[model samples]
Target: MPTILMRYRAAALLGAAVIIAPLSVAAFSAHNVAAAAPTLSASPNTGGSFAPIVSADKPAVVTVTTVIKAENAGDEEASPFRGNSPFDEQFRQFFQDQGIPMPDQSPEPRQGQRAEALGSGFVVSADGYIVTNNHVIDKASGITVTLDDGTQLPAKLVGADPKNDLAVLKIKPSKPLATVGWGDSDALRVGDQVLAIGNPFGIGTTVTSGIVSARGRDLNSGPYDDFIQIDAPINHGNSGGPLVDAQGKVVGIDTAIYSPNGGSVGVGFAIPSDQARKVVATLMKDGSIEHGFIGVQIQPVTADIADAIGLGQPEGALVAGVNGGTPAAKAGLKAGDVINAFGGSPVKSPRDLSRMVADLSPGTSKSLSVWRTGQSRDVPITIGRNTGDQQ
Candidate 1:
């Protein structure tokens, strides 16, 4: 899994951050614009006031506070003031001269300190089923959920799937709780209006509105990288918050953001609600998810590699290696074979194949289309339960 950087940006600033990679922006001419008017008009709202939607969805959003025990608190880096830097003494003297309190010069380690973190979550069911990011309550000794009405209640972790960065929690509410319904994230399109509700920077429920900046974004975070990119200002403490559509349906879960500094850069990523719903359901039932596995190392077929392999287009996943005694090996899958399709679904890239394979049920048989020695052929393989050891 790739490291996801968490940052926050204010909701008021909507400027696009400079991405290192060049993004293709489509340009429309006057004639094309006129031709697309009808289609554009028929499409969902690309821009509008999300006040009504936010008002309805805000109540379901809750603030998640986690307390990690001292034993679980990770090591902290040495501070500059604690080191023997020449400026350290001067800094202390300057503070004293300016009538400011002197900084703590204690050499005590923080191993005894209990760490606390704040994030956001939303009620998914009236019975107090909540959805949040796994990282939010990771290694937490205690969890608490604060409702919109200022009611705080202890929560228990029902299940967590770190691979998907999602967790399901159960709370005993006094009564039926406000809940949000999941929407079909597949129906989302770029430029569609979205509302992000979360407790950013530990502040109370904050609602930010923006458009779906992009879709099917893969930030190299995990095997399931189908993230919905939104310009909605989500910052630190917003993780696990719901990204609601214009109709107040939960379309995605705010997870990570791209930022050079520790703030949002108008580029935030969310786990699509459609994918999350399945995980949440499984977690609620089994308390964990078991991913299907086919033992094979794969890589994306680059244009140069594709040409060399006689493939006209850069597509599918190229098998780099095969694990012995595994399903792929038993099924006659070999290195250099390009997997074009799995279970009748076209594999667009290595990540696509990874996600498809992981979603399969273990011990199930599936047909795979492979390109080998300049020809395509179908091979049947039985999916195996992931042992949590394979990369």
Candidate 2:
């Protein structure tokens, strides 16, 4: 699979790159009128403060440290350094600058070298159930959860949904632990104030304030790419942290940041709580997630392609190809068919169709509306269980 540049710094890339172009709509001419800018009677922060919210919710957040045994330690293809060495690039550059032909040196085998990674997570239940990013503990030999009071407890992986970069963990706490409730992320609007709590760069818990910069952001991470884009100062170790709203409810889970320097640049992405809540519930019940699949390669319907296909507007998923023996091929779906709707819900883009299809249950029959040869038709398909290989 082609590597996607946008990824969770704490974990591996989830999926391939999906290019979704924004549709531009033309506006009709109307009578022009002057409007006045709205004004507030008082400042926007007249009665707003994040101190109380942070003080109450910080305890539920925890630092997650993962240890990978030496045997499992290896260099990632995307990483410039070899064997996770911090000075690999500097040493090579120094030798090159000195005009010295340095001989190739193999890394010395260490007996018990361990790679440690730090991330953040929040308690979702009082009985020691915690929610964190799947990348945080990926391939970890040992996992530990450190509470706000400096108490550390061994944690076991309950379930992980790599498709959504979410994981559920279980720990045997001496007593009931503090937990945070999920909030309605659908209600969050752009410019709404949000607070981020996490452990950045392995430091202690930190709080930062920012606004919801955008909604439904897709960094081509996975089929489920409905991310809440915020300007919070989340860094490398902030993965799996909670993005709380004014009421101190977990509206989003900090997952990835857009940075070239491996640091926060005021552009961070989070998994919405509504989606996280559904996945967490299933993970708690089932050991893994079973995604619904209808094998077909799809792309966005651009304006030029829409016009060529006689579509008035650029909408729906343009089917580029269909795999054999799959639900789409079995349902007689063709290459040129544009999926306008699935299971009675409209698909505005390829990502929307992908998300809708994956959310369905396997073995269930769904009515798919498609645009074929300048006309529309319905095709019924039996959803199939995704074995983690198909798109």
In the range 162-201, model 2's lDDT, one tens digit per residue, is 7777888888887767667667899999999988888765
Provide the global lDDT of candidate 1 against the true structure: 0.69
Alpha-carbon TM-score of each model against the true structure: 0.76, 0.78
lDDT of each: 0.69, 0.70
Compared with the true structure, what per-residue lDDT tens digits does model 1 show for residues 135-205? Answer: 67767788888888878889999988877878888788887766666777899999988878887766577
Q: What's the lDDT of the predicted structure labeled candidate 2?
A: 0.70
- Candidate 1: list runs displaced more than 4 Å: 1-48, 75-109, 303-313, 389-391
Range of the 10 consecutive residues with the lowest summed lDDT in candidate 2: 17-26
Candidate 1, residue 170: the lDDT equals 79
Candidate with top TM-score is 2
**lDDT score, candidate 1, position 136:** 72
